[model samples]
Target: MKIIAALVTASINKPVSTTIGLLILFMLSAMTVVAEQLPPPSATTEYSKEGADTCLQCHDQDSKFPVLAIFNSPHGNKNTKHGPFSSAGLQCETCHGAAAAHTVKRLRKGQVRAAMISFKTKDVISNDEKNQLCLACHQATTTRHWLGSVHQSNDLACTDCHQIHISDDPILNKAQQLEQCGQCHTKEKVANHSVFSHPLTSGQMGCTDCHSPHDANNNQLLVSDSVNETCYQCHAEKRGPFLWEHEPVTDNCLNCHRPHGSNQAALLTQRAPYLCQNCHNSDGHPSFSYGSDDAQGQQASAFLLGRSCANCHAKIHGSNHPSGYKFQR
Candidate 1:
C-alpha cells in the first residue's frame, strides 16, 4: 500500500512521473495486483472489532484517504441508528462490508490484503452487486423506478453520479448535474452549446425539469405523459382549447419544434412559410412561386411571401377570436 502511495505522491510532486503513476493507479484499481490485492471471499466475511474506528485510524486527516468531511454528510451522522456512529455499531463496514480481515496488524511488503468491496465498476466488484448495497437503503422515493431506468439498463451504478462520502454531491446542483449527465450524453451536450437551446446550460432550467432520469414508465424520460404536456408546464398559455384549434398544435410539439436545440428561431424544425408549406402548399395554397418576374401571377398568393404563414394567421396556436375559423385572429 505504501508503494502505491509513493507512486501517486511522486506523480503529484514530479510532473514527469505522471505516466508511471497512472499505470500504477490503473493496476491498483483492479484490486488484483499484489499491492492492493484482497484475499478470498471466505477470509473476509467478518466485521472489524473496532468497526469504523479501526478504518478511520488510517483514513483520518494527514492520511492518503482522508474522510473527516463525511461527518458533514448524512451517512456520517452518529445520532441515527442507521448511520456509521449508530448504537449497534457497524460504521465503515456498513457500506464497505467487513474489514476485520483487512486490519491485520500491519501489511508486510508485497503481501495481499483481504478482499474489500470498493464499490467501483471496473474493480473486482460487479456493478450490480455494488448497486444492490445502495439500493438496500435507497430503494424508495426518487429511486423507486430505478429497476429498468435508462441509466440502470445501461449498467450504471449509483456511485457513477453520486458522491456518497462527500458533503457536497455535484448531482444535487442543476448546472453541475448537466455536466455529470453530459459525460455520457455527448450529443445533448453538443446541442446545448448550439445557438438556441433550453436554459439548462445557463442554469436557469435543469434536465429534471422535463425528465425523470430514474423513471422508465414515462416516454423519452419525460416528466409527463407526452412532450406537449411537458412543454405546457412552462408554456401553459399555448395549451388552450380555443374557439379555433390547429389540429397539429394539439398533436405533438415535436411536429414543428426541436425541443433540445435548433438553428431556427422558436426552435422550429424549419423556416416559417416553408414550414407551413410542408402541409398547406397543396390544398388551394399556391404551388408555384409568386416571384417578381412571374407573368402568371396569383395576386392573392403574394400574402404568403411575407416569410411566414403566421403573418396573416396571427393566432397560429389557436384563436379565441370569434372571426377565427381559419385561425387568423
Candidate 2:
C-alpha cells in the first residue's frame, strides 16, 4: 500500500500516466485473485479402464437403470469415428466421469454409493457443472454461442432438453418437440392452441424453425436478424421491396400480426376496421363506423358486411401498383 501510495504521489505531476499505471496494477491484482480462487483440476479415475462393457453389467436391459437402449442411438454407433463410444473408446465414463468410488466392490448387501456424476441425482454439483460436461464436446458447433446464451444464464442443463441414454431424444422429434418446449414455455403452448395459430399441432411448423434455442444473435432467440426477417422465411411474398410499402409492415410484422396465435383470423392482433382504426383515423371513409345499422344501407354496407376495411384495401400488406399510395388495390 505504501509503495503504491508513493508511486501515485511521485506520478501526481503526470495525471494521465498515473491513472494508466494504477489501472494496470488493479488489473494485475484482479488476475492474481482470480487465479488463486480457481479450483484444482480434477484427477482421472479408474472407471475408464473397461469402457461401456463394465457399465453395461449393472445397467443392462434387466437392471432397473437400463442403459442398453443407448446401443440404438448414434452415440452407441461404434462405426462413427467421432462418436462417444468409438472416439478413444471413452463410452460411459466420457459423460458420467470416472467413478472410482461407485465401481468399488460392495462390502455389505444394502450398501450402494453414488456415481461420480449423476444428472438425475438431487444435490449433485449444479446445472452449470452438469452443462460443462456436455459443453466440453458441444462448444465448437451448435452451442458456440452457449456461453452467454439465455439458457446458460438461466442455468438450463443440456439434459433438460435432451435424453442421452434413450434411443430417441424427444426434443429432436417434430411431433414431440413442442411437448418438451411446453414444459418451460407454457404461454407459447397455450397460444398454439388458439383459434388462429400456426400449424404447430399438425407438425407443419416447429418452434426451432423460427427459434434457435441453442443460441441466437437476435432477440426472442429468432433464427434471423429481426422478427420481420424470421417471418419472411415462410411469408416470402410479403418480403417485397414494393413501390409502396405499408409503414408498419415494413417496420415489423408484430405491429399487426401475432407470430404465435390469436383469436382473430389471419393471426391478426385484432379484427379489421377496428385494427385499421387504431392507425388509420383519416377524415371521412377510413374513420367511418361499420355497425349492424350500416347493413341496412346501400353500397357502403357491403364493405361493413364482409371483410370491413379489408374489403377495399385488399393489398393491405403492401402494393406494387403505381396507384397504391393508400395500400388499396
Candidate 3:
C-alpha cells in the first residue's frame, strides 16, 4: 500500500514539472522573436570602396543606367576638391549609400533585394531622408531657406527636379525648364501660353528668374519679398517712391495687372473705361456711361474712343508733375 501511494505522487509531480518546463521554453522563444524585431543600430562608418568604377561594372549604360554620362557632369569632376569624385569623395556611395550588399552575388532564385538608396524607388527611405543626403552638401547659398520652402513642405524631393547623372539638367536649361515645371504646374503652363503672357515660350525668361525653387520667403516661390517686388526685378521703372502714389499700384501690382497672363492688352485684368469704372464712381465725367449710344454723342464718343481713359490719364502708374493729380500729363 505504501509503494503504490508513492508511485502515484511521483507520476503526478512528473507531468507538472514537464508542463512548467515547456511554458518556460515558450516564453524564451517569444522574447527572442521580440528582440529580433527591434531595429538595428545605425551604421556609423563608410563603406570600403575605391571609386565609381566598381559601381559602373554592374550599372552601365546597357544595364538600364546611364552610368558613363556622369563622367560629363560636375559631380564626376575629379580635379575639383569639392567634387564628388575627389580624393576624399565616396563616389557612387556618396549619394547611393553602400554597395556591398547590392553588388554581391546570391544563389537565391527570387529577385535580388535593394541594398542601396534609390530616389525613384517607392520602398526606399522617405522623401525627407533622400533630400537630407543632397542637402548635406547643398545647404549653402541658394538652398539656405530650403527647410520651409513650398517645395520642401510639399514633400518634393531634390531628385524630382534635378538629374544627377546627366551633363545638363533639364530644369537648369531655360528652354527646357517650362516643360519640367509644367509637369506639376499645369495651370501655370496654360496661363503662360495666353495672349499677354511673359516671354517664357520664346526663351527670353525662365521660371527660375522670378522664383527660387529651393527656398523663398514669399508666396508663389518668388525670389523677392512680394509679387510687386519680383515684377520690379525686370520692370524697375514701375518701382517708385513717386511724388504722387497710386494706392492700388503701391499696395500690389496684381490689383490692376495679372502677372501670369491676360486676354486684355498690357496684362490688364479688364479693358479700360470698364477697368477704370471699378474704382472711380465719382459724379460727373468719371461716372459717365460711355457705352450709352445717345444724342449726347460727342461726350460719350470721347470716353469710348481709342485708348479710352488712357487717352487722357496717360501717366496712370503715377506722376511727379504738379498738374498730374488726375494722372494726365
Candidate that would win on lDDT: 2
In candidate 2, list every pair of residues with a backbone clash: none
- Against the correct fold, how does model 2 do in TM-score? 0.82
How do all the candidates rank in terms of lDDT, highest first? 2, 3, 1
lDDT of 3 by residue, 20-99 (tens): 66556666867888899864321222463545766787678888776788888888888866667888888878887765
**Pairs that clash in candidate 3:** none
After superposition, the stretches of candidate 2 with alpha carbons farther than 4 Å from their true spots are 1-44, 109-112, 121-123, 286-302
lDDT of each: 0.77, 0.79, 0.77
lDDT of 2 by residue, 176-241 (tens): 777889999999899989999998888887888888988988659999989999999999999999
TM-score of each: 0.76, 0.82, 0.80
**96, model 1: CA deviation in Å?**
1.1
Compared with the true structure, model 1 gives a TM-score of: 0.76
Give the TM-score comparing model 3 with the true structure, all chains together. 0.80
CA lDDT for candidate 1:
0.77
